[model samples]
Target: MNWIFLILGGLFEIGFTTCLGKAKEATGSTTYMWYGGFILCLFASMALLIKATQTLPLGTAYAVWTGIGAVGTVLIGILFFKEPADFWRVFFIFTLIASIVGLKAVSSH
Candidate 1:
């Protein structure tokens, strides 16, 4: 359950980040809508992270949460924002993912 919440929190973090970028690009009333979505996702992500930390180690939870968000954000940037997908960047992303998996494997529920 805590793991589920953690994953959801991470995904929501991605949502807020994407929405934040959209908000910056939007004009007039539409900007407010994007901002609103960003705010909503931000709160949701934080709430779930808090819930997860109740059961998981704080340090591990935080590291994994940020890892997921960082990986997702970078992937989104490459796919949607046309950011460069150089070899070193790709290699590092996979390394981060492997580290996340290692943390999960060693953690107790």
Candidate 2:
């Protein structure tokens, strides 16, 4: 289903973004692997997003995809990369989630 593709695309977007962050910290040959993986995942996710948008409205698909990706990436950054996880950061993330959900609900009609 189109939603499935959108979900997958969002997941891959998170994957690529996380990998890019890792690549920035990497050194030597392993850096290339991370960069390459990031690029591959980015392109793959974009293709799937395009496919999903064909069936779903562009606005809905983009909002959902970006919302999921943003949340997932921040979580990954905090958990895996030891990024700052202050109260303000968490609060903003929750706000973003709420807005995204609201938008999706309102637009679905």
Candidate 3:
């Protein structure tokens, strides 16, 4: 259950970050809308993370959450932001994913 919340938090982390980039690109009233969405997502993400920490070890939870967000955000950048999908970049992303999985497997809770 805590893992679920943690993963949700991670996904929301991705959401807020992407929205933040969009917010930066927005102009005038649209900028305020984007910023509002960004803030909402950011708060939701943090709230879920706080919930997850109630049961999960903080170090493991934070690492896994950030790991998922980082990997997800990078993939999103590749797909939507026209970032290069170079070999080394993909390799490290997979490595981070593997590490996150390993951490989940080793975690007691």
Candidate 4:
């Protein structure tokens, strides 16, 4: 379904972000490898997004996609990049999650 495609697109968004972070810490040919991964993930994410938008409401799909990406990227940063997971960050993430769920619940398709 398009909703599944949208969610997968969001996950690829997270993949691209994670690749960028890894690239920053990489050296020599490894950096290029991560960049290649970035390009691949970016293309896949956009393709899926375009597919999902064909049937889904553009506004809702976009918001949900970005919501998943944002929340996922932040968690990835904390888990892999040693980024701080302070209280406010955690709180806002929960709020963002709630908003994403609310959007899904109210959507017609």
By lDDT, who's the top model here? 4
Provide the lDDT at 80 for model 3.
85
Question: Candidate 4, residues 1-109: lDDT per residue as tens digits?
Answer: 9999999999999999999999999999999999999999999999999999999999999999999999999999999999999999999999999999999999999
Give model 2's clash tally: 0
Candidate 3 residues lying further than 4 Å off, grouped into runs, are: none
lDDT score of residue 55 within candidate 1: 94
Question: Which residue window of length 10 is worst by lDDT in model 1?
Answer: 17-26
Quote model 1's TM-score.
0.97
Ranking by lDDT: 4, 1, 3, 2
Give candidate 4 misplaced runs (Cα > 4 Å): none
For each candidate, the alpha-carbon lDDT, in order, equals 0.96, 0.92, 0.94, 0.98
lDDT of 1 by residue, 1-109 (tens): 9999999999999999999988888999999999999999999999999999999999899999999999999999999888999999999999999999999999987
Can you tell me which runs of candidate 2 are displaced by over 4 Å?
none
lDDT per residue for candidate 2 within 1-109, as digits (tens), equals: 8888988999999999988999999999989999999999999999999999987889889999999899999999999999999999999999989987887678653
Clashes of each: 0, 0, 0, 0
Report how far off residue 86 is in candidate 4 (Å): 0.8
Note the residue pairs that clash in candidate 3: none
lDDT at position 69, candidate 2: 97
Q: What are the TM-scores, per candidate, against the unseen true structure?
A: 0.97, 0.90, 0.97, 0.99
Candidate 1 collision pairs = none
In angstroms, how far off is 5's CA in candidate 4?
Answer: 0.2
Candidate 1 — which residues are off by over 4 angstroms? none
